[model samples]
Structures are given as structure tokens and as C-alpha cells.
Target: MEEWVIGPRLYNCYKCGNMICRHDDIVSKTFQEDRRLITGLHTVADVYCCDCGERLGWRYIKAYEEMYKYKEGKIVLEKFKLANENNW
Candidate 1:
């Protein structure tokens, strides 16, 4: 089992005033790992707009699992990555 964490900031759609929702955010890389070493880190930010019925940005991270549930009764999975301290 992998432990996951979300930022204190809640993401909202820049194009719309819809509040972004997430089901899961999994981090495969630890805080100390080098991001460059990981090829194609799976970072997804699965989201959708109820009013416009548009698919928002998804897959923003290099290696993460993000799930979203929309008000219109829809579920999506998003993945993303975090900045690697080792890379700095």
C-alpha cells in the first residue's frame, strides 16, 4: 500500500469557477528521489466541468494517482508529480 498526500491548496478550474475534486493522489517517488531519473513520471490531474461538460487538465504529475468525482456524477483518475528535493 502506498501513502499519498494532497497539498493544502485546493485546485480550482482557472477557466471556470468550479471547485476541483480529487479521489486519490499517490506518490511513487519519495521526497528525496531525483525526478530526472524517473522516466515519464505519471502525474495526472483528472477533472471535469459540470457546466461546460468539458474535460479539464489531467495527468500533470510525473508519477502520481489522482481521482476526481464531479457534481454531475462522474469519476476520473489523474496523476502528477512533486518537485524532487534531490534535484535541487
Candidate 2:
């Protein structure tokens, strides 16, 4: 599996302060990305905070399984503790 990113360089849903560890979470949509080096083996999922309905980010799900590793249907994001620190 790919190295799970965390720490200083991570994402936090500013709209709702939803961390990826929350019990209730899910990816609500699929968005586009710069897939130049990618082999189209993944589907981008739009993650959100279940409590506040805030967008987290796009998830790269394996094409074969079509499932999420974070929650039941959410991606396990290494969200930054604070807001918009190194998010650029």
C-alpha cells in the first residue's frame, strides 16, 4: 500500500473541522485531478464530514474494490490538527 501521509502536511475540512478518525464519515462524490502519471486505476471520491456535511478532499479508490479504507465509505485522511497551516 502507499505510504499514508500525516503530520504537518495534511488536510482538514475547514468547513466543519471534521477529522478523518470520526466514526461517521463518507465520500459523497467523485472529482477530477491531474492524472498524468496515473494509470486510471483509481476513482476520486469526494469525502465529507458526516456531522457537518463538509468536503474533506478527493480519495483515490482502487478501481477493482471500489471501497474506502477510512470509514465504512470514507477515506482515512491524515488531517492536520490545525487549520490551513501547510495546506497549499
Candidate 3:
């Protein structure tokens, strides 16, 4: 008999094919506020790709409102800049 195993799903940088993060690492999708969006204010830092230095997205450095405090220290990566490792 043969044994089989499965690996965790991975997402890679689309440009340089660098391993970015795992699918299970994603937290939420409704926490985005564009850097240029003026309706609300948030203090965030740009998140760059480690290998290629591509501007992948931003990290929530500070959230002004108490309700949004949970977003602090979280990062959001652009969907277009990610590729599933299995697709490679």
C-alpha cells in the first residue's frame, strides 16, 4: 500500500514567482480602504514584495476608530499580484 499526503495551499508573487503567503493566512476581504480614498482616513504602510520589491499592497499601521482597531497590524495583498502555487 502507498501513503499519500497533502500540502498547504500557497500564494506566490505574480511578478517574480516568489512565495508570498498561504491561502489559510488570509484574514478578511472587507477591510480595504484605498490609499487615495478620501471618504475615511487610515494610517497604513505600503507592503512590498520581498524578492522583487513590487508594491503588493499595504499594512494597517493605525486605525483611528475603535471599531477598526482590529485591523491594526494586518496586511492586505492585491488579488492581481498573487498567483496560486498549484497553477504554476
Candidate 4:
């Protein structure tokens, strides 16, 4: 299993002012092929606040000449917790 470092960078809810941990939150990644005759793989990361549960922004991972958008959502922490508890 691959592990990613959960940065200490704090994210606060705009409405509730609650601190959120990225490691314990949900993150979605989307990927698609460019419609144009481009040559590259494109991907986007949709980061959510997890506190107020609002979408933060769409971070482009793979850069390409044309733009291709696809949405993929997952509750990473919840899945991890469930896996740890042997739910799966």
C-alpha cells in the first residue's frame, strides 16, 4: 500500500471555523483523456474541506494541451478506518 504524507497545513471551515485534517478527510481525484488531438494524460484533484464539507478547489495533476474533465469521489479516511476495523 502506498502512503502519502498528510501535511500539517491547516484548513478551516469558512462557515463553522473548524479545523480539518486532510488525513482524516475525503479527497476525490478525476481523470480523463483530452478530447482534442493532444498527447498527454490529464487528471484533476478535487480537494474538500471535510469540516464544512465543501469543495476547496480543483487541482490539475496531469497537464495536457487540451482540457479533459472527469469526476471521481471517495471517502478515503472512512474507507481506511473501515479497512482497519476489518469491515472489508
Candidate 5:
């Protein structure tokens, strides 16, 4: 018989292999334009990996719409800049 084990999925920095976050922590995966995300226009600042300084994505500074207010203090990580922990 074979046994399978499931572990917590994680996201790591593509360049430095430093642990960045967990897959479950993701809030949304929407396209970004200028300083806005697809859900609503927002003011954002670039987020970086503390260990490598690689540009990971951006943190929302402000959300213009009332419905998106919850996203104001959240962050969005670029999928391409992260590697699945299992891959490494």
C-alpha cells in the first residue's frame, strides 16, 4: 500500500528561495493596471522580498470604492515571481 501525505502549500521567492507566504493567504488574483487592480481602482506600492529585495508585487494603499475597502491594507503577490514550495 502507498501512503500520501498532504502538507501546507507555500509560496517562495523565485530568485532567493525564501519563504514568502502561503497559498491559503491569497486574497485575490486579479490583473493590475497602473496603480489599480481589476476589482477596483486603487493606490498601491510595490512589495518586495525582505531577504532578496525582489519585486514580488504590490500592497494596496487605498481603494476608491466602498465595496473594496477591505483590500486597502492587503497585498497582491505576482504569480510569476513566486515558486511553489514543492517545486524547490
Candidate 6:
């Protein structure tokens, strides 16, 4: 549940031709590249691959009010699940 799959991409690490699964904390690290508070709260980050240090993607951080939209899709996706979806 850590990595968001049903929302806009937070990571697009295809340079290594690899794909990351849910909540892949070990694969990437995001560092804020630019942040502006006076502009009504916004943040930009650079996501890098943890393995080969490749640039993955850029992330736009948002607060709860605006950020909740990104999560709404996940909640809806939860309604469709296999019986053994968590068997791993």
C-alpha cells in the first residue's frame, strides 16, 4: 500500500528497464528540488533510482486537501480484489 499504482506516476524508472512494485522503499529516494510556500503550498522533487543512481522521475508534492485526489483511486480500486491478493 506504500507505492501508489492506481494514481498518476510518481516514479517512471524505465532507464534500467525495471519495474517497481508496491511500497518499494528500497528502489527509489525522492529529494525536494524546489519548494515554494508562498505560492499556496507546492513542492517539486527529483526521484532517483537507489540501485544505479539513475534519474527516475519528478514528483509534485501536495497537501492533504489536494493530495487526497491521488489517493481516491486507490480506495476505489480496493473494492476489486482477489481472495488471495495478499497471499504473498
Segments in model 4 whose C-alpha atoms lie over 4 Å from true places: 1-11, 20-42, 65-88
> Could you estimate the TM-score for every candidate?
0.27, 0.34, 0.82, 0.31, 0.74, 0.30
Q: Which stretches of candidate 3 lie over 4 Å from their true place?
A: 1-5, 29-33, 37-39
Tens-digit lDDT track of model 2 for 1-88: 7996655533346666544442223243232335341444555676666768766554555554333233333343434322453545
Clashing pairs in 5: none
Kindly report which residue stretches of model 6 are placed more than 4 angstroms away from their true locations once superposed.
Answer: 1-12, 22-41, 63-88
Alpha carbon lDDT of each predicted model: 0.38, 0.46, 0.83, 0.42, 0.83, 0.37
Going through the candidates in the order shown, the clash numbers are 19, 1, 0, 0, 0, 1
Where in model 5 is the C-alpha error above 4 Å?
1-5, 29-41
The residue-level lDDT of candidate 1 at 34 comes to 36
lDDT, candidate 6, 1-88, per-residue tens: 5884454232223445344334443232332232343334544455555655665544545434564435222211111111122233
**Candidate 4 local lDDT, residue 66:** 42
Q: How does candidate 5 fare on TM-score?
A: 0.74
In model 3, where is the ten-residue run with the lowest total lDDT? 31-40
Tens digits of per-residue lDDT, candidate 5, 1-88, equal 9998888899999999999987777766565544435677788899999999999988889888999898788887877888988764
What are the C-alpha RMSDs, in order, of all predicted structures?
Answer: 14.0, 11.6, 2.6, 13.1, 3.0, 13.7
Worst 10 residues of 1 by lDDT: 65-74
TM-score of candidate 6 versus the correct structure, residues matched by position: 0.30
Candidates 3 and 4 compared by lDDT, better number: 3
**What are the per-residue Cα lDDT tens digits for candidate 3 across 1-88?**
9996678889999999999998788986455656674545678899998999999999888878777787789898988888888764
Query: How well does candidate 1 match the true structure in TM-score terms?
Result: 0.27
lDDT of 6 at 45: 59
Q: Per-residue lDDT for 1-88 in model 4, tens only?
A: 9996644444354555555444234443232333342445645565665656666444555554443333223222222111121112
